[model samples]
Target chain A: MTGNIFYFLTFLTLIAAVGVVVSKNPVYSVLFMILTFFALTGHYILLNAQFVAAVNFIVYMGAIMVLFLFVIMFLNMREDTEQHKPMLSKIAAAIAGGMLFVIIIAALKDVDTNVYHPAVFDSQIGLVENLGIVLFRDYLLPFELASILLLAAMAGAVMLGKREPGERNRF
Target chain B: MELSVLLIKALIIVAVFGVTLLIATYSTYAERKVAAFIQDRVGPNRAGPMGLLQPLADAVKLFFKEEFVPANANKFLFIAGPSLAMLTACMSSAVIPFGNTLYINGEYIPVQAIEVNIGILYIFGVVALGVYGIMIGGWASNNKFSLLGAIRAASQNISYELAMGMSIIALLVLSGSLSLRVMAEQQGQDLFGISGMNWNIFYQPLGFLIFLVCAFAETNRVPFDLPECETELVGGYHTEYSSMGMGLYLFAEYVNIFVASAVMATLYFGGYNFPFMYDLGLPHNVVTILGTVVLFVKILLFIFFFMWVRWTLPRFRYDQLMNLGWKILIPLSILNVVLTAGAILLKDEFFK
Candidate 1:
């Protein structure tokens, strides 16, 4: 039954992912992407990665997608202006995607056949405390570095986004 | 083996949803009455004996009103937007513990919908996703006003959410638990045998204050409600919504306010814990009911406070709102976290 549920979610996720590209309206495409992310969050829950599921919901569904939707809405692009790529380029892109998928599956198959799993699926691992312990204790340096990266990103964004006193001429 | 447990759980879910809907329905009337009183107007007293039936009449009117869709609007998304808003608003209530637990025939059933370990995170996640409803609805309206409203909501959400999360982090540092149930239990430690002083409010006063201000902003309530202010963006995000679509947006705001209030009560107001609750030594079922009542009282007080502020304060200007959210509240909340951590490290001596 759980496997069937997983398959259903996977099917929906894939459909939504495809819809993200196929949708003519940018608004609809952003919504489809949000739907895909939600389905992925469900997958995280099924894997007993509750913290990951929550983070995915907060980050993907909450913050990032909000900005995407905002920009799409702010631009309010009409469907008439869509720039369709050449058919040959689309075919080539699909072929490249298929190759990448095959490569990933092949790599995973070898891991399933050979490399022993070290991470046990203990439900406790999904609790916030344990996740914090691992992130702060085990990955402290990397976490700090990631935060520093965010700080720099924020600084750059502020600098670039701020309107100059002389910039009103453009508007 | 336990059909009764499943039945009870189902009943609780339905009950919680029903109660929330009922509360949100009446909140409209409450908001109007409070506004009228504040403004020295007579208020909606015509519906039925002091406007007791005002919400019912208002709801009926909304249902009977024209359901509109703009000529150029995206059909599917226009409909999905309000429904999504209402859905996410109700979804956040699932993980909240209304009370402790009720016992029957040697079985214990928790009052909450689901006792997920990551209860707080679950709520934060759901509440964060709620912006999409406004964004989608506003954009689908295809009006410039709607677009502006959606933009304001997106920006306001980004600004206030950070401070809100920071404030919660301060509470978590002191409470030492992410699960709402455990946090409530931890706060059961009476302060010198005093009842409510044992609450987190006594310890993390600054965090509670920051959380309160952010809560106002998050709900898009007055003093921070630049998003939908009539003088500015013209109905904000719901500028083009009519009938039940507009109704859902208004209803969802009340539900969000209720959820935020319940969270505040649960976190800092000792949840369902009453002063000298343990001293009562009451029976299990009795205690559960009492706790639930206490929790409701806290929720109602916060709701009243929300309404009172909405009536009393003028909406902030856009730049002022952003400045308050980003510059003032964020830094203060961060400072709160630092102070809380320092106090925790220095032991009881810091407070003494």
Candidate 2:
């Protein structure tokens, strides 16, 4: 049953990933991205990473995707209004994506499958206790660095987002 | 699990689903009746026995109304909006521990749906996903008013969720567990060495206050409901939604309220732990049933409080809503976490 569910989720995730690129409307693309995230969450659950699954659902589908949808809607975009890219640029973009995909596959091919094999995936690894210990004890410096980076990004956002007196009242 | 065990689990799931629907249904009537009573008028008295059947009538009316699809709206997304809203509204109920264990045929059955060790995180995650309902619904309506409502809802929910998470951090410090079941058990101790309920509300009143305020914002209730303000936004996010589509949005709010009330009660009020419950000298099954009733009473009280504040308080302006969430509640909740951590450390150093 679990294996069947995992395969089904994987199929759905792949389908949604294609849909994200294939859909014409930006809103539809966002919705497809959300579907893909849900499918990924299902895979996380199958691996007994319930905490990761839930957080992934909450952060991506709940918070970030909602903001994405907000921007798409606020712009009131239409398919007719889209500017077509040059054929050469489109071909180049596809090539770039393909190269990145091949690079990822080649890099990961040499890695041991046992790293993520279900049989080797300890159920306790996803528990908040164990995850917290590993994060704080073993990976404290990297975790703190990530936090510092996020703080800097947040400051940058506020600086850009704040309205200047001369730029106010345009509406 | 045996066939009978699976069957029992299935039955409980159905019961919980039905009860949640029933509660949501009656709450609409209760909100009106409460509003009328507050405003010095008879509310929904023409239906059946002081409008006891008003919600059923309302539901029938909603179903019969014309299902509208805006000419410019995204068809699939317009349909999906309400379905997602209602789905997430009811999803969090699975993690709530309704009562103690029931002894049936010499086997123990816990009065809860699936028990994930990260029960609290599960609830938070589901609650977070609920934002998509309003966001999608408003955006799909193809109306500027609806778009504004969606923006307000997204921003409000995101801001308030921070405070809510921080407030719960205090509870985690106090209980040292992420499971709601464990937190409830920790709060079930005797009050001051006597046979009384030891509720967490007494210890984490500041956190509770922050949680309560954030819950209102998260659910888009009064005093923070800028998204659906009638005067400014004209039904807010559901302006273009009609028929059962609109009905689903409204119904989801009631369900969210019921679930939020249940959460607040379980976290602070000792859940199903009644004061001196062991003193009753009842059978195990009977005690569990009584415990469930106690939890229900607490939930109902919280629901009433929600409605009371809704009718009594005025809505905040958009800026005010953001300011309250980002400035006041978040900072206060963070301070609460700091204080709770200090208290825990002091206890460990001195008492423990």
Candidate 3:
């Protein structure tokens, strides 16, 4: 039963990911991307990682995707209003994407697939209590440092967004 | 046994779904009645027996009305908007424990749909998704006012969610669990020599206040209801929506209110836990049933409070709404967390 669900979710994820790129309207693309996140969240739940699944659902599908939709709506993007891309950039983009795909396939070819077999599953690792202990006890320094990095980024954003004393024009 | 357990779970799920819809339906009638009471007028009295059947009447009217879609609107998304809102609104109730375990044929069954450990987080995720319905509806309308309403909703929901989560973190620290069931059960214990009187509200009043305010904003209730403030944005996101599309959006708001009320009761009001509960020496099943009734009473009172505030308060300007959410509520909730942590530490050190 679980295996069937996993396969179904994987199919959905892949289809939605492709849709995100192939959709003509920017709003449709954003909606497709949210579907992709939802499928990923389903995968996480199938793995018994409810904490990760809920966070992924909230942060990616809820907050980030809503903002993406917000911006896309504000732009009033339509297929007819879309700008024609230069042929040179299109070929360059295709080449870049193909290269990344090739690199991913090469990297995964060396991995031992047996580790991911259902027989070796460790459900406890994905639990919130266990994750909390690992972060605060074993990986405390790295976790704190990561938070500090986020804090610095927030400060940078505030600094950039703040208006000057004599500014009259609003962006 | 396993089959029976599955059947019981299915039964609970259906029951909860029915009850949520029923309460939400009545809440619409109650809201109008309360509004009329506050305004010194009779409300919906022409319906069956003092408007007892008003929601049914309203639903019939909505169903018979013409289905509408604007010429320029994105038809698929326009249809999906209110459906998504209703879907997310209904989904959050799965995690709320309505009562203590029910005993049937020597099996103990929890009175909730799903007993997941990350129940609170699941509710948060669903609540977060609730904004999508409004945003999609507004954007799909292809009107400038509708787009503005959608934008306002997105920002308002995002801003309030931060403080809501922060306030919840304070409660999580005290309870030491992410599950609403666990939190509710923890609050059932004795406090200050009164059995089943140990509510979180006694300890986390400030956190509760912040959460209450944020809930108002998150649900887009007045005075934080800038998104659909008809004075400014016509019908807001559902401007182009008609018939059941508009009905679903309105119905979804009541469902959201009901769920929020339940969450508040479960978290801080000692859900399904009544004072002197054990002193009566009642049978276990009887106590559980009574507790369930108490929980629903608490939920109804909260719903009434939501309407009460709606009629009493004036709508905030968009800038003032942002200021209250980002500047006042966020800082206050953060301070609540810090204070809760400090109090916990001090009690551990001195009292122990």
Query: Which of the numbered candidates is closest to the native, going by highest DockQ?
Result: 3
Which tens-of-lDDT digit does each residue in B26-47 have in candidate 3? 9999999999999999999888
Q: How does candidate 2 score on lDDT?
A: 0.89
Per-residue CA lDDT of model 2 for A1-171, tens digit only, reads: 998998899999999999999999898899899999999999998877777887898788877987888788777778899989999999999999999999999999999866667777577787778888999999999999999999999999999988987896667
Q: What share of the true interface contacts does each candidate keep?
A: 0.88, 0.85, 0.88
Clashing pairs in 3: none
lDDT of 1 at A136: 97
What tens-digit string does per-residue lDDT give for candidate 1 at A1-171?
899999999999999999999988887888899999999999999978888999999988899999888777777588788788999999999999999999999988856554435575366777677889999999999999999999999999999999987778565
Better candidate number, 2 or 3, judged by lDDT: 3
- lDDT, candidate 3, at B29: 100
Candidate 2: residue A155 Cα off by (Å): 2.5
lDDT of 1: 0.88
For candidate 2, lDDT tens digit of each residue in B177-281? 888888877777888664438899999999999999988988888888889988988988999988999999999999999999999999998899988887778
Off by over 4 Å in 2: A114-121, A163-171
Can you list the residue pairs that collide in candidate 1? none
Compute each candidate's TM-score over C-alphas.
0.94, 0.96, 0.98
